[model samples]
Target: MRQLFGFLLLFATAAPLSAAEIHDDIDADTGWQVITAQAGQTKIRVVPAAGFNVFSIEHAGRELLKTPPALADLPGVSYGVPLLYPSPNRVRNAQFTFDGKTYHFDANDGTNFIHGLVHNVPWTVRRTEVDAHQAVIEAELVFAPGTKHYAAFPLEHTLRVTVTVRPEGVSWKYEVDNTHGKSKVPFGFALHPWILYQGERKNTFLTIPATQWMEAENLLPTGKLVDLEGTPFDARAAKSLEGFVIDDVYSGMQSDHPTVADFRDEGIQLSLDASDDFTHLVVYTPENKNWFCVENQTCSTDAHNLYQQGLKAESHLLVAEPGETLSGTVNYRIRDARGHKFSRWEKAIRKFEAQDRQHPPAAGGTLFVGSSSIRFWDLPKYFPDRPVVNHGFGGSQMIDSLYFADRIVLPYQPRTIVVYAGDNDIAGGQSPETVAKDFQRFARKIHAALPETKIVYIAIKPSLRRWNLYEQMAKANDLIAAFAETDERITYADIATPMLNEQGTPKPELFIKDGLHLSPAGYELWTSVIEPLLPRAN
Candidate 1:
């Protein structure tokens, strides 16, 4: 019955649960078991059945991290934990040439050589033991030479990862033994832990001790280290991970030592420690997402290629001799530092907000505002013929639109302001009336502040996934159009009408696989709709 339910869920979510549904025991005597234990002020346990993982820290029975459904299914499993050959974050064309030969690997998320081949592969469970105070589990994963999945790199390797849990914290140790006899194997490795937390990730505090940072031209490291001075990349202290966009790799760390990252707020305090072998850390903070990643890596993106380029030092490469093994560890601990974090987070938010508020949006160029979908849009390409200033944020509602109107929309003094919003507000469960009112408020704010500026409200797009809210969205559009009618300066651009299919629903071809967001075709449609309304190129 459990297997049936798991299989059903896999199809429903479109996310495979092969790793998550590994039960505690295989029938009566064939599988692994889930173990639980408590230590000190923290409670810890392991899933010996699935990768021998450890998880669920508690102080007085309260969860330290947000236990979402996806997380609960894989109780103690860590996602994207790298082994053997750590993949690069971004690769040119998702393929790299090594030793004058081209190698192709799986592109997990559109463009990057993610977590390597070992990710999602099952590891054989070896042993499991649990006491009232602690639980320890161990596992061994062997990759045979010339295996089809890993045929790109023909090297036999035996990888062993051990996980230990206690009330103090949970620790993971990885050991990779090169079984390919007598020949040096060039490979990369990294650990990507899917961290979850409650409330806003922007409220969290993070610190990485490094003397210098690496600069990237196109996701590939330039092998250069600039001093960490007056840049957002500086993580020398416990700074709030808010309002800063980062997807770069940092090098020249104090040591090839495990660095500590802490998040303290809302009655919870959590800390993560990476191993000494983990030299580089990639900090990924997407706009408005509830979670952020502080990935510990042994080398930078495309390390193998970088190695060939002689861009990376010989010391940075981990060349395991015949029968030799490479090893490392990572630890996560939870504690209570709510008061400190609350005050710190509040101050941080105020400081960042003030910085944003101080810089009011100028009214001279094209002003783009609203949600991440807009922010993430390549403005240069999207408005190739016009000068555009991007002001879109992720997960922002109409209220945020009004709030940041001055900083974002008003600053450009744009001859024409192109507004692309309301999608997130609707998705956030806001009523159409409420969204309409917010739009009205936004219009009023813009008009009052810069009466000469022309306001062009792009109609809310029809998304296939959010078709249930199509009627409400149309109603909101109607209200906005009605409001536009009252002002000569306000113009409504009817994009939704053209974007709809014959059935009067959102055209599926316009949406990406996610159904809610636009694909390249959708963007092209938007570009066509907006091109005419924009002022003639100066």
Candidate 2:
């Protein structure tokens, strides 16, 4: 029954378990189709009549997508997530030749055609669903002869988009069919979402896993790719968007990494995960603007013209033969960092859980948990005959261990648990008293679950690189040592004392060249000090 309950719980959590709501209503004043979907902490508003744009996304009571003040102003406003199709951004000279046919567009921006023809037009709603798992709305645009959209390109096709809202996040699936066209059509697709900042724009950090940037002239791709190394345009890692003035196209997207926007002041992280079909990402951070855009595009800007000019590598233009359909998906995920204290360790915890499921570690064994010191310790090499389970995650704090105790600690039903943390907490500016209290809280939580289980608190080690913080570390160790004396099940080991030389400084042999992490000699010393305190297996 216990095993069955575990499977049921996993099934329930694998998908959204709460009821979702979605409906299509008309605006009395504007007579526009206002579709809304809500599930859990996420709510999305889509205006299908106004180009099927998702204008608003509110999560945890905070607006993540930007919108105009008045719904009437949507025709002129490009703040919402708008679909850019056929062509994205500007096309050279307002025209491109495809299959012996020259297509001409209005020169809306100087000598170039900007955006697309269908972004501000009405779309036909096809489906709306509200269920226990997700809320969804599907809309389509058919471009045929006699329609304004078809007059611009003269090619017939249909574009269907489905937007889904669940507890996890919002997703968009786009399907394009060319059965109505007489010949193959060259096209592109992209989403231009004007991402808003929760607080000051300077406090937000942006990351794009792009290896190279498209070389451009006058905001148009120049058919060249430039390496991003040592360039200001390089945002391969999380970098503050403060004082940045950028409007460029990036390519060579890393298939495994997602683009992330971290609003530090709001404690929110927005990740944009796109399918492999997307080959280019456009990052636009205008000067003095309150909003920015990280667009996911199936092809580069001016792709049709670029491909016509024999610059095929620069333009990832896709050609769909008659009756062919192309599809892709993009997801917008929001993470409330304020609520999940251990969110950064989510992947690590999941990996540990997967390992446990495969091997099924026996209960009443010794469990060691903490930060890098505990993670790097070779328990199997040191205690070869004993039953020990390592659940250490690097760079974790005392509070992190406490926050995830139920998932990683209590589930094991360990007879004894050893902890070695607080090093990072002090380095992160937490008070020594606070660190000691956090460890106390973890101990209390563990004891409450396993009344007879013993706990051993390993003293924070002294390292040459952090010798300046040794005084505060010593204070934190002393406080935790005092608390251990009050409980018979709790034990405090003094590994810090032996790690220091007669001069009261950390021994050079104990640490590597970085002077922080332990060397082989240091782990051996730690093993000698901690092994005796391990409880016997039941």
Candidate 3:
């Protein structure tokens, strides 16, 4: 039997030419880097030497951020969204006592250490890529026990940061891991973003969702918390920064809550949503400078001194103990007053929510998710004795799992989960390596919250229609299989194997009429292979 074909590549505006791109370059003198990411009318540029922070964000040939003139000469932390590692703000006398040892930092901010060591240092660009949606760059910097980074901070740690620039917005993620094998390290972080607007202070409005402001002496918190009420610093709601000097550190954001600091000026709204890992917000509107800073912080200024003074109530510090890693995210989403193509998937996502509400699946089942193969699975016939929930959507990619994982998979709370994707991704021309990394990211997001749960990834299978991509699919499966070996919670089910015959060709009888989706016979083949990989139903 033969089936008709419908390829979306003909009429859809999603041309391969419109995809985003990232270019890596190096400076001649400083040996620094200039990484540029471009997508449609939206463009982003960064200097990895400058803490890998975004140096420019342009939309329709207009710069959205006001870049300082001395960007190349001045300290990076003073401009752009600087990666303030180790600590966010100023530390008194460039010194702090951690675990009964007084460590001294490089005194660049007069007598205090303004930003951590990586702001002016170099970082290695591990990976950079541009897909249909966004351009991403992953960079890392490490400090050894005898290096200057350890000389100042006295802790051996590594920081991996990733920056993503899409048409909708830009986001930055931080992962700080303790590398000393059995030791512990304490650290704090803040991303200092000085956003620029076109209008005057009175015309630009700023709002920060914070409840309390910490009173500080000489830029260090004095262990006193004052209510953010009745003062010029009360930016709980949108207010203009007119006629008042501004420099403040505020806390009291709810955990896991996204605290949005909205800045509207020149008919454009730049929304900075800091995750709960960031407990403090610093707003600096200097009377002399035209730009304003909306900083997301993880702790108070001079947190070590506050901790030494027994002010545990006001200080929030992060620790990297053995077998433990810490991560935080800051999403800077943008909304243009003019029309833009930002919410193309809103309808589909909304419909998904509506469907979930209308018919919710039972919790604590073996969850099957991803592309049409999983969607078209005859779960009852395959796994009749086990409890199973299938939430597979249309011909989806790896990112779709990340998009709807919280809504669908998280609610089920399955004892064991299985994902099948990357087929469409490879068919759409994404590299095998990129597909593997995307699957890794998806699994990490799940296990971050559900540590005890086991996750299984079904290797992208070969079908008759898309057999041209079988090699790439096999490579993707190989990479993911290797990654699964590194994580104890993940299991890689090599289902792509038996689907191929002895001649290394796809089994045509396994495919449906379209020669793409799986047939009942194909589902049977999967059942025979994947059942033994799953845990026995309790």
Candidate 4:
């Protein structure tokens, strides 16, 4: 299906556009397939013959991966990004019993088989394409009889990997097809990417978004989970890697937050967002080393043996029955710390676009856009009979709404638009003036593209947690309301004024336990204030 879409995109433009390009230069003995995107702002180098490994990923003239000094050293060096599959990290004694069969592997790492086969082997290039939006390279390896490593594992399966480079960032999709095999196959997948520190190594901040750590005695999980509270591997928040030496597997990964590496000195942030299949993460920050490894694994180390030992949940061993295709994606996004605010919301926007394609909302409906306040609102419950389209992405500010307006708002051609943002902007340290100015730009952009559309700006609400910022919120609301009065098509819904108590404090019952998000009563009150401004049900 992706290949078909790429083929369709090939004829999308009448004229040639230098958006993204794919080049294959294997005759030079380099055997590199390079894909460049965003007008050469980002480049990804893949060697199809060398395990289909993405050896180099350069962005903005900076190398993100740790590459060898010489090209000849690439094949032997363990640097760059390599996919560890079938079994990741290590297998106990290079042997594991799965189902009723026992298999053995080469002890590549001292009495244990580390990082399964196919990482350094040749793979067939299934497809490569360059479209206006992105460039893609798809490679596959058939792990059946006659294959190099098939005699050891003997699993008749096909592993397909697709790497895509776009303006936003790079994404990898790994898939395993076990349709031909009659037996249930057990496997694990992981990506070992040696990341180079962009600036000072000690100043590099890492956020793992994990709560539990796998207790390992010999570089392998011991089937025991430990809390990372006081351990040296507790990096749930953005913590500096100074004086920290860790090479451990972490569990209880939070799906909402991505594993991030913030280069504060370089003003660059590298984030890795993986699918739910990736429930475990391995962080390896060696002492006296300029590079660290943040590996996203589908299962814990020695998952097969651990699963056989009845530690199913902790092992996360994936079983593929007949005709099952196990697949997952991991996206690598790069953005500047000072700018590219909307890049973080690219996944959310893509999800919305995909939803639009499947079950599109009706045109000329009342559209709502904003931060978590709008995102958490039960639009259908509040306005049961009205036609409303909600595009509320949490953790968004006024500028995000304005930036994505063309994609989500204008395309809907809604008759009325309700916006409830700027709460997070002030909380995030942006000034009230900047928020109001952003809203002003948002209004102008909306009015320019959608002249007759009625825009109802929901005043930033007052919360108990941020009661101190009420003055700033009120100032922004006043600026927006005053601006709305100048425009006949705009309406400023002053929900903030009504949410306050007689003593001018935020009502405690109006907020949830967090004292920030709205309670049911608070949303009811907001509905009473903004429902009247919405388009009436016909």
lDDT of 2 by residue, 260-311 (tens): 9998765579988888878899999988878899999888888998899898
Q: Using lDDT, give the best candidate's number.
A: 2
Off by over 4 Å in 3: 1-17, 27-31, 68-71, 255-265, 337-538
lDDT-based ranking, best first?
A: 2, 4, 3, 1
What ranking emerges by TM-score with the best candidate at the front?
Answer: 2, 4, 3, 1
Worst 10 residues of 3 by lDDT: 1-10
Error of 4 at 362 (Å): 51
Question: Candidate 1 lDDT, tens digit per residue, 397-425?
Answer: 66666644533444445677778788876
Residue range 94-113, candidate 3, lDDT tens digits: 98887788888778778888
Per-residue C-alpha lDDT of model 4 across residues 1-538, encoded as one tens digit per residue: 0011221233222112244777544324453543333322466777776787787886644678987654445552287888888998989999999887899998988999999988877788888888867888888999888977788779888889999987567888999898887778799989899999977887799988997999998898999999989987788888998877888999987557799999876667999989999999988899888899999999999999999999999999999888999999988988866574666887887777777777777777898999999999999999898888888999999878876675567667788999989999899887787788778878877776568999999999989999898899899999989999999999999888888889989999998999999999999999999888876777
Question: Using Cα atoms with residue i matched to residue i, what is each candidate's TM-score against the true structure?
Answer: 0.51, 0.62, 0.58, 0.61
Regions of candidate 2 where Cα sits further than 4 Å from its true position: 1-18, 338-538
lDDT (C-alpha, whole model) for all candidates = 0.61, 0.83, 0.73, 0.82
Misplaced by over 4 Å in model 1 are 1-85, 97-102, 109-112, 130-133, 145-148, 254-258, 338-538
Backbone clash pairs for candidate 2 read: none
Most accurate candidate by TM-score:
2
Better of 1 and 4 by TM-score: 4
The alpha-carbon lDDT assigned to residue 439 of candidate 3 equals: 83
Worst 10 residues of 4 by lDDT: 1-10
